[model samples]
Structure formats: structure tokens, C-alpha cells
Target: MHILLHDFAGHPFQAELSRVLARRGHRVTHAWFAGDTGPKGRMARTEGDADTLAFLPAGQDLRYSKTDFLRRRAGDIAYGQELGQAICAMKPDVVISGNTPTEAQEGIQRACRQTGTPFIYWCQDFYSVAASRLLARKLPGPGHLIGGYYRFLERRQMRRASRVLHITESFRAQTDAWGIPRERVSVIPNWGALDEIGVLDRNTAWAQANGLGPGTRFLYSGTLAMKHNPELLAGLARAVTAGDQVVLVSAGVGADGLAARAADGTLPGMRVLPLQPFEVFPQVLASGDILLAVIEREAGTFSVPSKILSYLCAGRPIVLAAPGDNLAAQILRETGAGQVVEPEDTEGFAAAAQAFRDDPAARQAAGAAGRAYAEAHFDLERVADKFETLFSEARNGL
Candidate 1:
């Protein structure tokens, strides 16, 4: 079967899935936008194993802008049309869409219907909810109106999908409210690249070269957008005591904010860096003493941070600032891999970081537990097999 996977944000895990599916004798094409500035970036379009194709439309930029709402909306509509055209051209047996803008998803769904191609929605996050929260915060009165428009598009696309592969059960209620049948929704949690990320010693040359060898480092190594609270990281930095050699290393959006704060002498012992290449991600993850994950309370259960899975693979104890009932917190509690603090509790977050820093045995135990959990539950091959079954079922109209 020929399969096409579309995601506006080019994810490395999707590429890994394509390789796994192709190795199983299925032709797979992973299509994404060229404008994603995430960790994968251009590498997502260029690197893939044999029998798997990475498709990025030439000269197409679909990155969203915070300041230019009208321009961003227009770009999404244009990109949606282009994306539909591309899917129609491929004419794959099944199309899977994940992490797509609502408008773009509408276009893909419409194209699939017109072509009689079965398609599944690999629902990673609730886009309409996210847009509503963000726009409501920024635009006040008109945000709900704009968000309602996206919600309409979201409902149409979800109703049109042959199957909805939800990443968490938390989404079931919303889909149920939309009148989607329970049988049509399946819960398939996201998995980590256990093969790529592994336990590495902190004494490696990469750690020493990057100034990560001398102190207790708290690292956050993924996109920190509006859904995350950067001020929590700033608060953690401020809470570091004089005797503690705690350092904060951030490599994404929070890094930019923390860098500016450092320049102003507000965030001492904070080192901000650009997102690392995928090849060097293991080294970057290993350099940290404790991994950090944060989510805004407003995002609630609508989004789950995928970085937590990578942190699990890295075999490091995590300090997550998220709601207690959020999926990240639930995973940490279930796996015994990390500590979870409320998003607003800066002191609690600092305390957890200090405990991990001071207690080597506890940190080692947490790391080992996380590694064991990843091996048992987050294996890439296992995840690929689940996706294969879903694809087959969708193609057969099951």
C-alpha cells in the first residue's frame, strides 16, 4: 500500500514511521511544509531511509507569525490548497494527517473525499482549542469569533475522516460532543525514538565542550511556544541559591527569552543555545542533569508535550511544571520517572530540581526507571506496528 503522512510541523518521528512502514514492504511518503523551524527543519526534508520519500513543497513557507494574524491566516488557506493538490497528485491508498492547521486539514479531507482515498486523522493536539486560548488572550473580544470559524473547519474535517487516531483519551469527550462515534476513535499515545535517544554519560566530550560538566544543569530542549509558560523557567533561575551551581540550558523559544533576561542581568547561570541538530540530540539530552517540561494551565489537556517522551528516552529525571491531571504528569506518576509540580509553583519546581541535583542515588534511580519505561512502552517499532494495523483497517473500511 502507498501511504502519505502529512504534518505542517516536520517531525522526525513521522520520518521514522515512514522508514518502519517502508521496511515492512509498504511505500510511504512523508509530506510536510518547508517552513517549519522546529528541531527537524530542513533535515526532515532531506534525510530518510530507502523506500521512504520526504516531500516538502518547493518555495512554500507556512510558518505562523504572532504579530501578523491576517497574513498567517491567508498563508494557511493558501498552503491548504497546495497541500490538497499534493495529496490528490499522490493518490495514495491511505492518507494520515497530524499536527496540521484546521484550514489545511479541511483541504486535505476535501481532497481525500474527492479522490475516494481513505484518510485517518492522527490527532496529536486540539488546534481549535489552542487557537481559541491564544487568540482570546491576545485579541480579547474577536478571538472567539475567529476561533469559532476554525472550530467549524475542525468539526467538518473530523467528521470526514475514516478514522481518528487520538494521542490521548482526553480528546474523546470533545469528539463525543462533536457527535463522532466512539468506535471511530482510537487512543494511540505518542512514542519516543528509543533507538536514537539513549543513556549517555555526562562526562562525554560534548558535555565538557558545551560547559555542562561542572554544574547541575536543568535543560529544556524543544519548542516553547504560547502553550508553555517561560516565566516559570525565569522563576526557577531566580530561585537558585548562592551555594548551588544550578544552571539552566534552554534551546528553543524559552532560550530566546532567557537569553534576553540574562543580558539584562536577571537570569544568572542561565545559558541559552539554538536547537541542536537531530544527530547531536542525544548528546544534548545527556548533558542535562535534570530535564524540564512546562505547559500553561490554559492549554490544559488539549496538548501534550512530546519532549517529555524524548526526556524519557534520555534516561534523565524530569521536573515538569504542568497541571496535576495533565498527561505529562500522569505519565511521570505512572512510570516513577520524574516529579510534577503545578505550573504556578515556582518554589516547588526549584525544590524538586534541588533534590534531584543533590541526591545522586535518587537521580540515578529515576533515570533507570525512565529508561526501563521507554524500552517497555515507547519503542518505535511497536508504535509503527500499531500505525500499520490502523492503516490497514482504514483502507479496508473497517
Candidate 2:
């Protein structure tokens, strides 16, 4: 089968999905905005023919560039037309859209209609709710307007999709609210690279090279956006009085403020390091004694953080700061691999950190459990099989 994977707001997970599907003996091609810089692994040939202009930032926090913003809304129309052309040319058997923007949604839908192919919505995020809430929280006036428009597009897109693969049950529930048939939606959680499980010793080598001393390292990798709550992260920095050192190696956009604040504080044994290369990410994650999943209380407490999958695969104990009902928290509790604390509960997070630091056996047990859960449930090969089954069913109209 030939597959065209599209995501206007480019994400690494989309690329991962393409790889999984392709490895299962399907031809895959990726269509993304020109400047979206997520990883594109061996899944398929990447073609930057997708309809939206990229909004990439100049520096580390990687904010959307002004050029991208000025061109995005209008370019989306062009994007849709071009996407339609691509579909006509490729004539793929299945079309998958990964969290598309408004313009791409309409474009991809048109392409699917014209090509007479089964369409799948690989839901990485609830675009309608997530994007609207994100914009409303960050940019009120124009953001709210755009968000409302995006929500409208989201409903239309969901209606047109032949199948929807949600990241969690809660995410799938959102689609059910729209009166889409429940059978059309299935739960497929984000997966970790199963190939990464064998690299434990590499973590030591990476730490030595990076000057991260041999001690209990608690890591919080990824972005530090507004939804990430800088103040709480700062509090955790200040609260780490345990003998075990606290080192934060941040990568991706949005960590300058946290880094600046961490520097000014007189917290002993705390170091904020720069983001490492992707090659070393697995090792970096493995080297850590514990992983901290930080989401602001206001960023909607129920959303699952992608970092959890990586942390689980790395075999680390997690201290997740989010609502208890969130899918991530539920999974952590179910597997006995981590503990969840309220996003704003500094004392609770601090206490949890201290307990892990004090109890090596407990930390090891949690790490082992996390690794086992990741291998059994979050393996890429296993996830690929799930997708194959779904794709086969969608193709057969089952």
C-alpha cells in the first residue's frame, strides 16, 4: 500500500508512525510544512510539498518565525490546492493526516475525496481543543478567533476520516462527543523506540563526555513553554536539598527563563545543561536516576505528555506533575513505575524526589517496572502491528 502522511504542524511522532507503517511493507511519503524541523527517520521519503509555510524560530526556544506567520494563513489555501495535486499524482491507497491545521485539513480532505482512498486521522493532539485553548491562553484576540475557526475545521475533518487513532481513551472520547461512530475510533498510545532499550551503558559514556558527574541525575527533557510552568520548575530546583545532585539537561525550544532563574539561584548541586543531540537522547535519558514530567496546572491537567513514553522506555522512575486522571498518570499508577503529584504541589514533588534519592532499591524497582511496561506496550514493532491491523481493517471497510 502507498501512504501519504501529512501534518501541517510537524511533529516527530508523525514521522515515527510513517517509519512503523513503512517497515510493515507499505510505501510511505511525508508531506509537511517547509520549515517544520522534527525528525524524519527511515519511515519514508520526505517531500516538502505540503501546503503551509513553516513557522520556525531563529534561536533555541524556536519560536515561530514572523515570515512563517505572515505567510501561513494565506499559504494554507495554496497548501490545500497543492496537497490535492499531490494526492491526485500519488493515488495512494490510504491517506493519514496528523494534527493538521485548518487549511491542511480542508486540503487533505479534498485529496482523500478525489483519490477515493481511505483516510485516517492519527490524533497526536486534540487540535480543536488543544490549539484553541493554547491560542486563547497565549494570544487572546486573534488567537481566539483562529482557534474557533480551527475547531470548526476539526469537526469537519473528524467527520470525513474513515478511522481515528487516538493517543488515549480520553482523546478518543472527545471524538465520540462529536457523534462519530465509536467503532471508527481506536486507542493507540504513543510509542518509544524499542531499539533504545539496549543502550544503558551508553548513558554512562555520554554523562562522562558531557561532564555530568556520577550521581543521581533527575532529568526534565524537552520544551519549557508557558504550559510548562517555569515557577514550579524553579521551586523544584530550590527544593532539591537531598545529597543526590539535581541536573536539568533541557533541549528544544523554551528553557531560557528557567535556565536564567536556575543560574541566579544559589541551589547547590543543580546544573542546567544545554540540549544534547538526538543521537545521545536515549543515553541521556537512561543515565538519569529519575525523569520529571512537568506540565503546568493550567495546560489542561488531563493531557498526556509525549515525554512519558520516552521516559518509560529509558527505564527511569517518573515524578509526573499533572492531574491524577490524566492518561499518563493512570498509566504510571497502573504499571507501578512512577508517582503523580499535582502540578502546583512543590512540596509533594520535592518529597517524591527525596524519597527516590534516599531509596535506591525503590527507584530501581520503579525503573524496572517502567522498562517492562514500555517493552510490552510501547514498543515500536508492537505499535506497527497495531497500525497494520487498523490499516487492513480500514482498507477492507471492516
Candidate 3:
């Protein structure tokens, strides 16, 4: 099968999916906005460069965030038409896109209609107004207006698409709120990108580079985005008892604010390391005694994060700071591999951290469980098989 994949966010999952499909003998072509913060260079078509399919004309990039929905623009329709032309030439067996804003999705759907392709919307991020309410709390009038407009466009896209690949079971419930039928949605949670997951001996390097000791290492990797309440981890760092140290290695531009928060002498046991290439993530993760996945308490948190999958695959115990009802927390409970506490409950997080530091046996047991669970459920090869089955079923009109 020939597949055309559009990922405005360029998430590693998209690239991992493409590689898995290619390995399975499918001709997979991937497209995305290179500037997207998620995947970075992982999905580049050529060495050191983004794929031409992901290229966007200057001043025409259609970015959609919580605040982007209210501003109605003609550029969206133009971008949609442009995408339609690109897919028309591919003559793909299927057209699929992930994390595309509704405005861009409109264009992709129109393109699929024009090219007679089966379109699938893979919802990694829920662009619901509830997300804005949860994160921003008080959005400006313009933001609210944009949110309303995008929601309407998303509803339209749901009606047109052949299927919706959701990152969480909760995502389907959210889409159903917009009237998408049950048959049109499928659940495929995020999986570890083995291509991105490689070894890095950060522990040995940390001693020479940062003069760190063999303290119980708690690691925080990835971006310092607003949704990621890393400050909470910093706050909990002050409560670390005995020989526990929190090592924060943040990447990308989003780390600036988090760095500032960490540097203010607010969190005693925490240290912020500079960003490194994405390739070293697995090694950095391996150096840690526990991995911290923190998110703010809010309505939209039921959404799953890609980091949880990566942490699980690293075979490290996870100290997740999210609502218990969230998919991340639920997965932890289901796997019996990690501990989940409510977001903003710094005392709970600190206690969990102290308990893990004191109980090595318990930590090892949980870590082993997480690693096994990841191998069983979140492995790229296994996930790709499920995706291929879904694609075949959708194309066969089953």
C-alpha cells in the first residue's frame, strides 16, 4: 500500500509509524511542518534537512493553538487547496494526518475529497475549548472566538474523515461530544520511537561534566511547555530527603522559562542541565533512578502524553504528577509499574520520591513491570501491525 501521511506537528510517533509501515513493505511518504516543536529532526526526509512535503511558504504557516481558533483567515483555505494538490500527485492508497489544526485539517479533507483518498485524522492533541479553559483559565475574547471557530471546523472534519485515530480512549469520548460516530474512531495510544530511543551514558558523563555523584537520580527531560508544569517538580525538589537529587535536562526553546524557575533558588535539590540532541534521550533516561512526568491539574489532562511511553520503555520507575483519572495515571495503575499522584500535590510527589529512594527493591520491581509493559504494548512494531490492520480494514470498507 502507498500511504501519504501529513503531520503538522511532526511528532516522533508519525515518523515511527512511517518507518514501521515502510518496514512492512508499504510505500510511506511523510509530510509535516518542520518548525513543529514535537518531532524535530527525527522525521527528516534527508540527512540534516526536513522533507520537502513539510515545507510551508513563508507567512503561510497555519499554526493552531488554543488561541489560534478565533481568528478567521483566508490563508487556511489556501493552505488546504495547496495540500490537496500535493496529495493528488501522490495518488496514495490513503491520506492520514496527525495534530493538524482544524483549519489545516479543512484543507487536507478538501484535498482528500478532491483526490478520492480515504482520510484519517490522528488526534494526538485535543484541540478542545476545554483545553484552553484548563490551561489558560481566562482566555481573551479573541481567543474564545478562535476556539469556537476551530471547534466548528473540527466537527466538519470529523464528519468527512474515514477514521479518527485517537491517542486516548478519552479522546474518542470528546469527539463523540461533537457527534462523530463510534465506528469512525479507533484507539492507538502513543508508542516509543525506538529510532529515537538509543543509549547515552549520561551518568558517567555527568560525573566528568557536571561533578555529580551517585545520588538517587530523578530526571526530567523534554520541553518546558506551559502544559508541562515542571515548576512543580522543582518545588518538590526542595523536599528531597537524604541522598536524592533531581536532574533536569530540558531541550528546545521551551526550557527558558523552566530554567528561570529552577534558577531562582526555589528548589534546593534540583539542577537544570542544558538541552542536548534528541538522540541521547535513552541514555539520559537510563541514568535516572526515576523519571518525572508532570502536568498541571486541569480538565484536558485526561489526554495521554508521549513522554509516558518513552519513560516506560526506558525501564525506569516513573513519578507521574497528573490527575489520577488521566490516561497517564491510569496506564501506570494498569501496568503496576509507576506511582501516580494528583498534579500540584507537591507533598505527595515528594513522599513518593522519598519512598522510592528508600525502597530500592520496590523501585526495581515497579521499573521491571513498566519495562515489560512497554515492550508488550508500546513497541513500535506491535503498534504498526495494529495500524496496518486498521488501514486495511478502513480501505476494505469493513
Candidate 4:
């Protein structure tokens, strides 16, 4: 079978999935937008048996610019059209679209319908909910109108999909209301690329080289967007005792915010660094005494932070601030691999971090438990097998 997977955000896991499917005797094409600035810089294409296609030209980074919102929206529409044309040209046996903008998804759905191709909606997050939240803050009166428009588009795409692969069980309720049958929806949570990440000692060379050994490092790695609560790190820094030696390290947007705060003498003991390369991810992850994950209360239900899965692979105790009902928080509670606090509870977040910092034995135990859970549920091969079966089923109209 010829399989095509598209993730607008250019997630490495999607690329890994293409490789996994290729290894399983299927021709796979993983497609993504070139504008996305991941850990690795933009590439027109990647060399592999499973062809990697990057649509759009390089140097189109517009994700963080509020002034370019309208321009970005127009770009999204153009990119969608381009992606639709590419899909039509490829004419793969099956297409799986994940983490796509509603506009792009609609384009793909239309293209699939026109070409008579079976495709699955690999929904990692609901864009309509996010759009509503973001636009409500930016443009109060017209936000609802625009959000409703996207929701309508999303419903159409969801209804037309041959299968809907939801990352969380909570997503099924909304799609079910669209009259999508339960049989057509499957909850296949996201997984980490365990082959690329391994458990390493905190005293590894990377840790020592980065000056991470002397202090209790609390690291937050990955994109820190509107969905994250930046104040959580600020409050944690302010609350830690003088002798605690608790340092906060951030790599993405959060790092930029924290670095600015540190410059202004507001956030003490915070170190900001650029995102590490994928090759040294394991070592970078291992340098931390504890990993931090935060989600805004409103966004928690619509999205699960994939960083939590990667943190699990690093064998570190995680401290997550999210709604109690969030899938990420629920997993932590069930596995006992980390601590979950309400998004607004700064004191609880700080106390959890301090507890892990003070007690090495407890931290080690939690880290071990997290690794065990990752081994069981987050192995890349296991996740790929599930996707392979789903793709085959969709292709065969099963």
C-alpha cells in the first residue's frame, strides 16, 4: 500500500511513523510544511526509502508574530491548496492527516473525496477549540464568528473521514455528536520515539558540560505557546528556598519569556537555552532533576503535551500543572510516575518540585516508574503497528 501522512507542524514522530510503515513493507510519504521551525532547520526534502515532502519554501516563520496574523491566515489557505494539489499528484492508497489547520484539513478532505482515496484523520488536537480560545482573547466580537466558521469546516472533515484516530478518549464526544459512528473512531494516544531517546544518568557528560550537576534542575523543553502557563515557572522560582539550589531551564518560547524576566530581575535562578538538537535529546533530558509540563486550564481538554511522553523516556520525575481531568494529568495519577497539580495552584507545583528535589530516592523511584510506563505504552514500534493496522483497515474499507 502507498501511505501518505501529513502533519502541518512537522512533528518528528510523524516522520518516524513513515519510516516504521516503510519497514512494514508499505510505500510511505510523510509530508509537512516547510515553514515550521522545528529543532532542525527547514529542509526542502529528506532522503529516505519513504519519501519526505516539505511543502512551501524555507524562511516563512510566522508563528510568533501577532502583527502577521492576517498574513499567516492567508498563508495557511495557500499552503492548504498546495498540499491538496500535492496529495492529488501523489494519489496514495491511503492518507493520514494529523495536527493540521482546519483550512488545510478541509483541502485534504476535498482532495481525497475527489480522488476517491480513503484517509484517516489523526487528530492530535482540536484546532477549532484552540482558535476559539485564542481569538476570544485577540478579537472579542469577531472571534466567535470566525471560530464557528472553523468548527463547521472541522465537522465536515470529521464526518467525511474514513476513520478518526483520536489521541485522547475525551475527543470522541464532540465527533460523536457529528454523527460519526463509534466504530469509525479509535483512541490511539501519541507515543514517544523510544528508539531515538534512551535513559541516561544525570551525571552524564552532557549534564556536567552544561553545568547541570550542582543544582536541582527543573527543565521545561518544547514549544511554549499560549496553551502553557508561564506563570507557573515564575511562581516556582520565587517560592524556592535560598538553599534549595533549584534552577529552572527552558528551551523554547518559555525560555525567551523567562530570560526576559531574569534580565529584569524578576525571575531568579532561571537559565534559558535554545532548543537542543534531536541527536542529543536524551542527554539534554537526563541533565534535569525534574521535568516540568504545564497546560492552561482551557487548553488541557483539547490537547495533550507530547513533551510528557518524551520526558517519560528520559526517566525523570515529571511535575505537571493541568486540569485534574486532563488526559496528561490522569496518566500521571494512574502511573504514579509524576505529580499533577491544578493549573492555578502555584504552591502545589512548587511543593511538588521541592519534594522531588529534596528526596533523591523518591525522585529516582518516580523516574523509574515513568520509564516503565513508557516502555509499556510509548514504544515507537508498538505505536506504528497500531497505525499500520488502522491504515490497512481504512484502505480495505474494513
C-alpha RMSD of each candidate structure in angstroms: 2.3, 5.4, 4.2, 3.0
Query: What does the lDDT read for residue 248 in candidate 4?
Result: 44
The estimated TM-scores of all candidates read: 0.93, 0.81, 0.83, 0.90
Candidate with top lDDT is: 1
Candidate 4, residue 71: CA error in Å?
2.4
User: Which rank order by TM-score, best down to worst?
Assistant: 1, 4, 3, 2
List the candidate 4 regions with Cα displacement exceeding 4 Å.
38-67, 241-254
Report how far off residue 116 is in candidate 3 (Å).
Answer: 2.3
lDDT of 1 at 205: 66
Best by TM-score: 1
Residues 191-239 of candidate 1 have per-residue lDDT tens digits of: 8788888899876666677666466777878776777788877777787
Model 3 spans with C-alpha error above 4 angstroms: 39-41, 45-85, 140-144, 194-212, 241-244, 251-254, 264-268, 299-302, 396-398
Q: Which pairs in model 1 have colliding backbones?
A: none
TM-score of 3: 0.83
Residue 61 of candidate 4: its Cα lDDT? 49
**What are the per-residue Cα lDDT tens digits for candidate 4 across 1-398?**
87887877666566677776776777767677766544432223445543433233322443433236677677677677777887788798998998887876887888899899997998898888877777777789898888888888887888889999999889898887878889889888887767667888777776677666466788777766667778888888887665333344444455577778877878666666666666676787888888998998767878888888888888899999998878888888998889999989998998999889889898999999888998898777778779878987898787
Residues 63-122 of candidate 2 have per-residue lDDT tens digits of: 333235456565656666777777888788887777565665777788788778898887
lDDT of 4: 0.77
Off by over 4 Å in 2: 7-17, 31-63, 66-88, 102-104, 138-145, 199-203, 242-245, 251-253, 263-270, 396-398
* Candidate 1 lDDT: 0.79
